[model samples]
Target: MRPLDLLLAVGVMLIWGYNFVIAKYGLAELPPLLFMALRFGLVALLLVPFVRMPRGRWRDVLILAVMLGLTHFSLMFVGLAHVDAAVAAIVIQVQVPASAFLAMVLFGDRIGWRRALGMAVAIGGVAILAGEPRHSSALWAIGLIVTAAIVWAGANIQMKRMTDLDPSTINGWMSLLAAPMLLCASLLIEDGQWQAVTRASGWAWMAVAFQAVIVVIFSYAIWYRLLRTYSVNQTMPYTLLVPVFGVLSGVLFLDEPASWSLLLGGIATLIGVGIIILRRPKAVEAQAQVT
Candidate 1:
């Protein structure tokens, strides 16, 4: 990667890493589903006019809308509401191994012993993290986040299948389809949404806008451009920095306590994910880029 592109990649990671803390702030004021609805709605409003249709792939785009936009994000924010941001960051890396396993099972993608061991180590680290005493009360939340990761991994497989679509187009249509569905879900399942939206603090609304505009639209535009400009190996490795920044931001901004178990398990988890990401075949690495 060129130095300029390297800087851009790192910028995206920083924005995304701090996004956990930002989402935590927004979720404080709005219901999880409602917050997600607003975020996607804003993205759709901003980008739908600019994004071209995926031509023959509308059905797949809708599936991505439901899977990535609705299911994964809803569970993620709800889980974040219940658990510490640092934990959410570390645990979400499970998507790496989860995607690898899914590729093997669903697509008959072969995994070498090294990748297999990486998957085991990553899962084991998550188990250790979940078993920590400080996080006992959050086991349900952790479970939700892990399930979200699986859903996210599934969406990645879908993305891999539709490799011809532009990333921005996919994202735009997904946001367009998802906004209404998520709003309907929020209306059905959550209470006091009107009150929450009306009473939301300025900072909370700013967080929502930031997530939509900066994290979803701007960061992804840069990310896709980098992927187009450089090899996946050059760009994908920088994503490991996301969890690192997440942990650090959680500690600094939220004053979240990181127990020894969290630190150790997080390191082990990231290491395992790094192994899977860095050492996997190029084909597998390309699939992992969808995350």
Candidate 2:
């Protein structure tokens, strides 16, 4: 990563980190599914004109949209409405381990003992965090977010199959496919969609715009550019900064308390994820062969 690219990576981290707080604000004013519908609908509307139709993988694209755009975001935003933003940020890191585990099961990807240990430590940390008395009421919400992470991991697996497609085009088509599906889900499962839209404040609308345009479109455009320019190992590590920024922003802006459990568990989880992510490829392959 060049110095400029590093700065861009950090900028994307910041945008994503603050997104939890932004989503919280938007959820305050609207139902979770409806808010998600608006976010994806706006992104689709803006990018569909410029992005070309995906070639010969419409089913995969729709599946990815359902897994990532509809299922993941709907559960996540609803969980955010019920839990603290800082906790949401920390808990969502489980996606890393979840993805690794899924690969092991689904594709026979072999992870070494060290990586296995990292997954255990990460799961343990999430368990400890959830067991905290302060967050007892949010256990269900935590489960929802963790399940969302699993869905996200599944989407990542789907993404690997679509590696030839441009990231922006994938996002654009996924959003286009997801918008109506999510809106229909909102109509069936949630009340007050129309009322929420009618009554949404300017700040809430701004939150939606920020999520749609900045977080999804702009940051992802730059992210794909960086991935093209740099090795995955060089750029992937910076993502650890997301939860750091998320927790800090929640504390600073949302006045969310960071308890001892949160700090310890979050640190453990991040460290574990870091180890798994930074491990050498040859080591992983060697372990797999031995196993």
Candidate 3:
């Protein structure tokens, strides 16, 4: 990666890191689901013109929209609403392992014993994190967040299948498709919708705009470009920083607790997931040939 690309990746890390804080703050003014709906709606509207639905990928786009956009974000925001952002950040990092496991089962992608052990360790960390309820509904909320991760991984795998399309096109069109359903769900589930809209402060409005435009649209477009230019394993590890940022941002902004279990579990999860993440696709293929 060039210095500029590295910088862009770092910038993405910071934005996503602080995303938890932004969402937490934004949710203070609006319902979690509604906030997601509005955020994606703004993203969809902005990208509506430039986004073209790719050939041979309408179904993939819809699947990605549901997996990546609606199911992932909705569960994530709801989980964030219930749990501490920092821990939520750490817990969500388990998505890497979730993806690895799903790949093994769904696609017959190779998973060596080392990666399997890492998965076990990662799940164990989650268990430790969940055992402590005083830390903020760790059990139920973690389930929601993990579900978001699995869905996201499935979406990513789907994205990888659409070889002709770029990531920007996928990101834009998926957001547009997912927005309306999110909006309708928000309306049905959350109250004080119009009031939240009317009473939102300038900063809150800016938060929403920042999330929609910067985080969801522009940054993701840049990320997908990076994914195309680089290897997935190389790019995927960079996302590990997102949760790191999430922890830091939540601590600084939300004053979320920095407990021992969170730190320990986070470290264990990172180390475990890193084992799987740092492995090369070629190595996996080689290992598969042997097995």
Candidate 4:
């Protein structure tokens, strides 16, 4: 990767990593589904003018809504409600191996022996992390996170199928489709909608706005560019740092405890996934054509 691209990648990672802490703080004052609804609603409004239906392949667009926008965000928000964002960050990193393994089973994609071993180590680390959590709710939260990752992996495949559109166009349309589902879910599940809206503090509104504009709208443009320009496996490893930042932010801001198991499992996850990412195809060559 060029220095600029590398820096961009790291910057994206930091934004995502810090977001866990932000989401944790956001959740303190807002219900998970309600917060998600507002976040997507704002994103939809910002993006609506730019949004266009996916040309020639509407199925890919629908897939993106379900996998990338709806399923991923909803489960993740619910999961965040159950655990610290930092821990959620760490645990969610396993999606790399999950996608790889899913590819192997679903598409017969080859995972050379080394990658196979890495996958094993990563899975073991996740198991240890889940077991180490004292609260049963935390374990369930991990399940929710993994579910979100699975949906995200599916979305990645959908994105790969749509080679016709620019990243911004794709993201705008997907966000638009996803917004209503989230809003309806929130309305059905959450009580006192008008009161909740009125009672929400400025900080909560800021959090929702940041998530909508920064995290989903802006950051995702960068991310989708990366996805389109590089092979899925090639750019995925940078995501490991997300959990590291997540955990640190949690400790520093949320004052969440850092347990031995969390620390060990996190390290194991980073090391194992790092090996997989580094061993995969170089991204420099692929990014050149896109850039």
Candidate 5:
């Protein structure tokens, strides 16, 4: 890859990694489902005008909107509210190995010994992280995130079967569909959303805008380009930096405590995910979702 494109790839990682902290701050001023509703609604408003609608692939598109966009973010933010951004960032990496596990089970994809071992190591690392005594009280929240990761991995598997789906417009359509569903969910399950939206700080609103515009739209646009222009080996490896920046951002920006178990377990998890991502065939393109 060229120097400029490499920098772009790294920029995407930074945007996505920093978003963990961003979402945590955003959640302070907005309810999770309410915030997600606004974020996806704005994304749809911005993107739907530019991209073509998914006419024939509505089945796959709706599945993504409901499962990944609505359900995943709902669980993630709820879990994030009880945990540190660094933990959320690191824990979600479980999806990498889980995706591999699902691929092997559902599609009969070959899981070489190295990958199976990597998956085991990754799961073990997450167990260590989850068992950290400093945050053991939040096990229910952690469990929610783990469940979300598995569901997200399932969405990833479903995406693999959608050979005809266009990456460029699918996010737009998903957002368009999910925004209303999220709004309905928030109304049903949450309280004080009206107060939350009305009394939100400027920075809080900016955080929402940052997530919708920069993280989802801008970074994804660049990442899709990088994936199309370069081999998966060239573009995908830079994503390893997400947890590093995630940890750093939480520590530096949010003053979040980083326990020993967090550091060690996160390292182990990333190493295993590294194995899974790096071992992929050169030609196989990874799904563009980062969160």
Candidate 6:
């Protein structure tokens, strides 16, 4: 990658790293689904006009919205409400291997024994972190986060099928669809929606704005630009920084505890994720084989 693009990749990861903390702060004031509903609504209202429609790809985009915008964010924010952001970041790393494993099962993509071991090690780390919880509710919360990870992996799979569509187009239409879906979910299960909207502070709303603009629009724009230019292997390594920054931001900003189990489990998880992420793609492997 060029120096400027590398910097852009790093910037995206940084915002994502801090996003956990930012979202936690926001969720404290607003219901998780409602918070996401507002974020997507703003993104849709702002970007829908500037971007083209999916036209032929509505099914894929809508599935992505359900997987990522609805199920993943709903479970993630709800999980965030109960667990520490730092650990949540680490545990979510399970998605790295989950994606690989899903690819193997769904598309006959190769993971081999190396990546298989990587998956086990990653899950074991989550198990360790899962044990760190003092209460059963926290375990359930962790499960929710893991389930979110699986859903997110499914969303990635959906994205692979929509490669011809611009990221902006996919996200724009997704936002317009997802906002109402999230609002309905929030209305059905959550109370105090009016109270949250009225009572949320400026900082809380700022957090939502950051997510909508920085994380969604700017960062993902750069991310897709990078992916278009370079191979996945080149950019995947940068994501390792997310949990590092997540831990630091959570520790320094939120004063969340950094117990020994957290340290051990987080390290183990990152190691496993690195093993999976740093691997070359099968297509690249085939190219090399031909050479």
In lDDT terms, which candidate is top? 1
RMSD of each: 1.5, 3.4, 3.6, 3.0, 2.3, 2.9
Cα lDDT listed for each candidate = 0.89, 0.87, 0.78, 0.76, 0.86, 0.85
157-205, model 2: which lDDT tens digit per residue?
7887787788778889999999999999999999988788999999899
* Candidate 6: 10-residue stretch with minimal lDDT: 282-291
lDDT of 1 at 272: 89
Clashing pairs in 5: none
Q: How many backbone clashes does candidate 2 have?
A: 0
- lDDT (Cα) of model 3: 0.78
Q: What lDDT is reached at residue 71 by model 4?
A: 82
What value does the lDDT take at residue 278 in candidate 5?
Answer: 81
Query: Poorest 10 consecutive residues of model 4 by lDDT?
Result: 282-291
Report the C-alpha lDDT of model 1 over 1-291, residue by residue, as the tens digit.
Answer: 778888899999999999999999998899999999999999988888987995678899998998999999999999999998889999999999998899889888888998888888888888889999878888999999999999999998888877777777877789999999999999999999999998999989999999999998899889988877677788889999999999999999999987888888888898889888888786676654553
Give the alpha carbon lDDT tens digit for every residue of 1-291 in model 6. 889989888888888999999998898899999999999998998789999875677777888888899999999989988998998899888888888888778878888777777788888888887887563568888999999999888887777677677778888899999999999999999999999999899989998899899899989887877776776767778989999889888998999999888888888899889888777566634332211
Q: Write the per-residue lDDT of candidate 4 for residues 193-262, one digit (tens) a residue.
A: 6777788788788889889888877887887677666765656667777888888888888888889888
Q: Score candidate 6 by lDDT.
A: 0.85
Candidate 5 structure quality by residue, lDDT tens digits, 125-153: 88889888877799999888988998899
**Superposed Cα deviation of residue 89, candidate 1 (Å):** 0.4
TM-score of 2: 0.95
Query: What's model 4's overall lDDT?
Result: 0.76
Better of 1 and 3 by lDDT: 1
TM-score of each: 0.96, 0.95, 0.90, 0.88, 0.95, 0.95
CA lDDT, candidate 4, residue 149: 79
